[model samples]
Target: MLRGQAKGMATLFGQMLPAESSQGAEKAVQWAEVAGRLQSIWTEFQVEQLSKASGEKSHYTDPVKWIATFEAVMRQLPLSNPQVQQGLWDEVIAVLTAVLGQYGMGPRAFEEAKGDPHMPLRDRRFADPEWRSKPIFAVLHQLYLLLSTQVMKHAEAIEDLEPGRKAQLIFAAKTIVDALSPANFPLTNPVALAKANETGGESLIRGFEHMLDDLRKGQLTHTNPAAFKLGENIAVTPGKVVHETDLFQIIQYTPTTDKVLATPLVIFPPWINRFYILDLNAKKSFVRWAVEQGLTVFMVSWKSADASMADLLWDDYIQAQIDAIDHVRERLKVPAVHTIGYCVAGTTLAATLAVLARKGEADKVASATFFTAQVDFEGAGDLKVFVDDQQIETIGQLSPEGYVDGRYLAATFNILRGNDLIWNYVEKNYLKGEEYPAFDLLHWNGDVTNLPARWHRDYLRDLYRDNRLVVADSLSACGVPIDLHRITTPAYVQAGREDHIAPPSSVWKFTHYLSGPQTFLLAGSGHIAGVVNPPSSGKYQYWTNDESPDTLEEFVAGAKEHPGSWWPHWVEWIRALGSDEVSARGKRRPGGRGDKVIEDAPGRYVMTR
Candidate 1:
């Protein structure tokens, strides 16, 4: 079956290239017509499917079947029609001409112009001794990039299909190009070639051994465990588990200051990973910094979900947050507590606040801060492509033992940045025979956690598919309807400028829902890096607009750029929101008012796997 599919794809491509004699303008016109015909074919297929199911439920809700149907119809598209083929042929000739011109220039021209910013071929691999000195290799690299660019252009030209389907097509085209990059193979990649020549091919032998070792372990080896140990070098924040439940443990870090704020800060880190991401190490730990700044910090460390916890629902998670918040309030003996939620936890926090508001008890949350979390899903970015009626159904089927495996969730996220998180590791560990580095952030990234199947399914259905979170009283949790607009707690919203998982634009939508004084911040870097940014690094800058513009674009346009991390700015914002300075209070011991110590700082839940 696979062989036949490969042959069919090859035949389709073969028919997509026109003869050399084809005219350019005429071919362009024909290509446009062919694109129109493909759209018509897609429309016809949809009509026929609808007609066949006139009196019955549609099978379009079954994503696996819907995808198969889409592929079948797409295969019938006249992509290889005469005019389209001619246009493709013209693109080919143009690339060929460019490649020949570069080849004729012969190595010397390239070497002299190597560092020029305007150079067409900017890839460093093309400048290596194995390729830069060889014209053929140089031309091959250029041709690959040129062809990939043209292919992507064609993919983008495809329209009239559903948004998800269109994105899938474009993604598939890009994946093909990425897979065929010259750096993946030993013969084409200069670095790999140099390694082969250096150790007499011993690197390849070692790489093969590493691959077998990973296979035996049934997982990709992302880090060398020997390089770093948990609770010693990493996750070493000094604290005690002041409270525990079946779902989560609250860790109260030992205070580093003599005077701490009266209002204790409670953090709800996303349960998708270990809570240690906020407390990775001394230098990078946000928890430590917050403590040093004279604040009592309590972190909710969630237990890793397994088969035993498969029946856990969304209400259960929300209740866990309430339980943690109540515990912090009771221990601190404060009327209200400041709250911080990261990613999915932020979403849950918003919902929890709404639930509290419905009961007229929302004043318990003095203020709220959301990091890389989205309350509105309309512009949720590329991750939305995977959240549809059919896709949700397929995911539901994959949840064995009532839980979505953490490895599967991790793999999905890796695909969002395939080059950095997936291919880079493949090249370094499998092709280059390099050992994984002892990076604290990378270690936290590799520590995956599972999600309850019911919770995962409901989240996608209610938030992404239905988009009920934005509508007042449309979403209900724990028998209480959630109206985001009803919660008037002061909010601090931060989004990463380059975040793909949760785009800055989506995060900006929080401005529309909140009724209190709100501050929006845009930080540089991706999701994790942007949120974990510390001031001492002096690496990335952040943007802020005092006006709080009505739209994301307006805020971005009027925002002032600030050097250094956003941490200090955040501290000031919290202080302004009634976290006043008080006499220093050292870290509260584990046992107080029926609150018993479960374990040490890192706790059992974080060390579960």
Candidate 2:
């Protein structure tokens, strides 16, 4: 299956080449050179390994060790080139001169700390008493930064390299430097050393115990599970489960206002996570805020896929959403319903809308709001690096149970932001023997859900790898062709400025694909924080442009900055779409089509382990 997919990808790449003869030939030659160089590099790496194994002091024969050694050397190969070495030496000399000039300039020269919020490693080793007051360590840190900068510059200067290859090279260099940082070692990391001294080595003992507990549980220690209960402290919004299916449950949130909008709102959250992300707490819940705004809201609580659900496919999810939408329309007795989709759900919703458009029933949706969703995966960011042929093939072979394990997905995401999600936890929980914080967000992050093998495979292929969703007739769902251009519903799209998962530029491209009047919001935080932002927080700001530009760069340039949350902006947009004020329903009604109430809000599906 993976080999076929790979061949298709090659075909797509070939088709993407410029139609012009000269340009096409030049690109072909560049691709050929890259392929040849990669092969040669691998060959040299194998030869070096064999040579090392035959030495007087033989290298470790472990396959894992060999692979790690090869990867490390490959990352440094570019730096070893004569041209790159020259550039790096020049940068080193310049940094040294700067450091020397600062020597006699008083305490101010040495006062600047190595740690910057942008640089994670600066805080580790440099924070130790031995290094903190020493000017030499500071100079060494600056020189390291200079070397990294120069290496990146060199990588970027490689002419005609594919964007993917360039990105990989830059990331590889970064990973190597991060791994080799002095801060990771116990002797060099002052914080770790001080903790050991203060605790008389108790911290290490406790850390060892924590590691054992985590291993036994088959997961990382991310949050204090005892600190939260689903229906109490976390998913506490008042609601009732009006319906249930094999795939999901529909929760009808009780209105907080005296009157509600005539057009009800329905939400489809990404199944990769629990639904409570939007309803994390009373203070942070978007669901609660919407309810207070007099919008009668209903949310789909997706079942955590297990062995029984391993056969579920993408079509199954889309159909379930369609069924939920129909149920909402009937239950609320509204001809049309407003819809919101978050993350993967947003992608699925877009596809469903296209299916609706094909069936001449697009009017069923009053309006569509997409939160950090991507239809065009062209600039999908670093996550793309892990979705290539070899990786996908490996996953396919391993997931014989017909589901991708949630733990693997969690680990991959954690690695993407290792400084915050992985290493910070390592330094605190393992080194410092600190307990994991009882933060609600981290708790939700740890509560992962499996993706059915078929669904996961198809999604990565059709969307991320094939780029089929944006291309008309290239993909289909629910037995109908999918195309974003066909959907005419007015859209409210939000993207995070600092979101590595779905870059703002990629999210902004949604405006270009949708034919309707689209409003693009650029939030100031990342994927989760940006969307969960409430006005009361007064934390992150957002940007908006009435005149949606053709390009993301232009939109950003001309956009007006707004203080606080984008919730009010979304509320106004939904209001403008013409939801009438009406008396709020006091009690839960039976779900549409005689579907019986299964349980209360934060229902069984959501509570699935």
User: What tens-digit string does per-residue lDDT give for candidate 2 at 1-609?
Assistant: 111222232233345568678877665555444334434544554575565434221122245754675476356457677886787788677767765555556666445632343122244435554554455654656666665556566656666767776676666555555555545544444565467545544454455456556644556768987889999899998888988888899999878787888889999999888999999999999999999998988999998877788778888988898899998887767788999999899989998888889889888899999999998998898888767776678677647678877777887788687667876676677656677778999999989888788788888887898888899988877898888899898889999999999998998887777887778899999999899999999988999888847888998899999989999999999999896788874342333345466677888888877
The per-model lDDT (C-alpha) reads 0.75, 0.75
Clashes of each: 2, 1
Error at 604, model 2, angstroms: 1.7
The residue pairs found clashing in candidate 1 are 258-584, 259-584
| Candidate 2 TM-score over all chains jointly | 0.82
* Superposed model 1: Cα runs more than 4 Å off: 1-79, 100-110, 113-121, 124-129, 133-136, 187-190, 579-595
Model 1 lDDT, residue 565, Cα: 90
Clashing pairs in 2: 128-190
Query: What are the runs in model 2 whose C-alpha is more than 4 Å off?
Result: 1-76, 82-130, 133-154, 586-596
